[model samples]
Target: MLQSYETLRQTGIATVRAQIRSGGYASHTAGLGRNLLQANLAIIPQEFALDFMRFCQRNPKPCPLIGASDTGNPILFTLGQDIDIRTDVPAYNIYRNGQLVQSVTEIGDLWTDDLVAFALGCSFTFEHALIEAGFELWHIANNVTVPMYRSSLETVPAGPFRGPTVVSMRMIPEERVEEAVAISARFPLAHGSPVHVGDPAAIGISDLSAPDWGDSVPQPAGHTPVFWACGVTPQAVIQQAALPLLITHKPGHMLITDVPDTAEIPIITNKNMPR
Candidate 1:
């Protein structure tokens, strides 16, 4: 079983698809690939795709656009050669009128001809970079989900999509805060850089122990909770928008793509241009 775990960790897109097809693995995709990109999934009607795309463009810090599928197609060739948006993710959340209606292992029955799939860069990609740069992550070490909060900062509105920016918090030792920032700053697509360094209440979070999503890990002595813009922001915005129908990967159960984690850097060359 340990070898099977290791095999899944090292497996590529094809192998993962096979496993997901066989119902052998149905959990969060975290820690599965050492250097592969995992993505946040958002599926919406084709009628709303353009507006959502603009929303993402306007709010790139929280909604970085990584890969988008063609209209009415579940295959995201740009993200991976054989990617199937419907079943690629480990788990999915089905929402109707902005309320979560069900959690499913796959969306084959829910898929429709008018649906459009989106693949957004996730901060998990940068977590690997942080670890590679010698920064320790508390959640990975403690085996807990990274805590996420809805920040006081508001995202720029585009169409009907507007809401508070949602951020994921990580506890970093005092000495390594700079290293964490420097490493994460290199991946803007994956919500690069720290939005807040200390004091959870500064960002509208009343208590660090309580998070809107994910399990909270205890902050150790001499460490501060560092926050970063998260891909979950879009889900929050969609909830607020009260869209008639929406679908997303369940929190932590991300879509693993064939895209190499090192394929893109987060640095912005044109500051004036939308990210």
Candidate 2:
């Protein structure tokens, strides 16, 4: 029975990667690996590596650099022990001249000697932390993708990278807003804390139900909508740049890492709320 539980626990991650490698699964990867760290994928030519690295350094909030590969290499050693960039992710978006041209399951045909891959920290890491802290994540409960919106806020630009920051929204009960804030703030890499809360339209979103990407979850009754910086921001910027060729993991289908989640959270406060 003990071994059975272990197998069940790893099933989601293993099955998803297997399907992705076999071309059986191709869709947004939300709520798939609930406990593991899921990463946002970004692949670029070696010609733009130094400038892009500086861009991430300038705007750490939206583009928290998690792991980077050597020039002309696709294998990310820091993320996974045996991660093959060509077939590990569930879906791949191919862009040319900054326009999305095709979406495929793998990019073995497109792998080149002058390419570099970057794995950025994703919000799913904090979602696991939130769940463990007893907060109810609406998207996970309802089995839908978290709502994402393009915000008016602009990131610090570098070279050809410049665009509005994209944020992911979650509906939290009003009473637990402070608790949610305290829990998420611990993760500085995966977009720590809420950027904006309360009304969606306040951040330039005209309608709460219609998100630019992913399915919108119902805010309902007494909950307040909260937003955080998302990993998708880099993808948006890349699309706007219109490079000759670029690739990224499909939204939600992240690259799982070998790094333990606890390594990211150093301090824990049990006071609940200050008196």
Give the per-residue lDDT of model 2 (tens digit) for 9-117.
3466666666666766655555556566677889999888777888888888788888888877777766655577899887888998988888888999999999999
**Residue runs of model 1 more than 4 Å from their true location after superposition:** 1-7, 265-275
The TM-score leader among the candidates is: 1
**Model 1 pairs whose backbones collide:** 188-266
How far residue 215's Cα lies from its native spot in candidate 1, in Å, is: 0.6
For model 2, the superposed segments whose C-alpha errors exceed 4 Å read 1-16, 265-275
* TM-score, one value per model: 0.91, 0.88
